[model samples]
Target: MRTSAPAAVLFDMDGTLVDTEVLWWETAREVAAGLGHRLTDADAPEVVGRAVADTAAHLIGVTGATPPPSPPPPTTGPPRWRAPQPS
Candidate 1:
């Protein structure tokens, strides 16, 4: 008889195998404070598991960064890539 390899492999990391949740929370708080927005425990749920870019965008909005320009009229071709705004 021959044995087959497993069909899938899952890795448990971060909060599952290691306790880095607090570290993440602290880092988020520091970043938010540096950006001039106070982060509270009440905001933890939303901040956790979010990408850095997403969080930065949120900070930009909260810190009164310039509003994005209105999109140009839609066209029929493939979408274009806009350069990321400076943080």
Candidate 2:
């Protein structure tokens, strides 16, 4: 079987490439609070940087419309993490 080569890279906004996964989860929790549903940090990382629809769908599956999808907060810090792909 032929394997496909990688074609892209992703970098963290924090520059350290540290798992901002927690940050996204925290933010999501805060946002979800407004809807009267409490989302735990464990549930947040799954939808970071996803489109509103995707986030909404995940939320629907998770808390059932507790957190309305919206634009995430602006990102800050140097670029972190990278994945190179062949062109």
Candidate 3:
């Protein structure tokens, strides 16, 4: 292990690395729309950079969504294809 002072560190607090912020915003907007709620620039504080569960809970509260309850019992056979395996 080399333990001199570190040469550098990297962080992406505001998406300079890959700029997925817009994708996150767009997806949140679409989901909000599906929940019969509308999201705008004003909603960013509650939606952007939030954990998925937190955002999901926020949407549920804002739109009175129950998020469809637990999933229905699994379908059998064909549509229930086996889980994928890595090569």
State every prediction's TM-score relative to the real structure.
Answer: 0.48, 0.40, 0.58
Candidate 2 lDDT (Cα, whole model)? Answer: 0.62
Q: What is the descending lDDT order? A: 3, 1, 2
Candidate 1 positional error at 86, Å: 43
Candidate 1 C-alpha lDDT tens digits along 1-87: 998666555544357777776777788778778767788867776667665555556656666655457533543356476445545
Tens digit of per-residue lDDT, candidate 3, span 1-87: 876544555656568787877888899999999889998788888888876666777788888887756644543345444445545
Highest TM-score scorer: 3
Point out where model 2 deviates above 4 Å.
1-16, 41-52, 60-87
Q: Considering TM-score, which of the candidate structures 2 and 3 is the better prediction for this target? A: 3
Worst 10 residues of 3 by lDDT: 74-83
Which candidate has the highest lDDT of all?
3
**The 10-residue segment with the lowest total lDDT in model 2:** 66-75
Model 3 clashes, total count: 0
Overall lDDT per candidate, in order of appearance: 0.64, 0.62, 0.75
Q: How far is candidate 1 from the true structure (C-alpha RMSD, Å)?
A: 11.9
Worst 10 residues of 1 by lDDT: 67-76
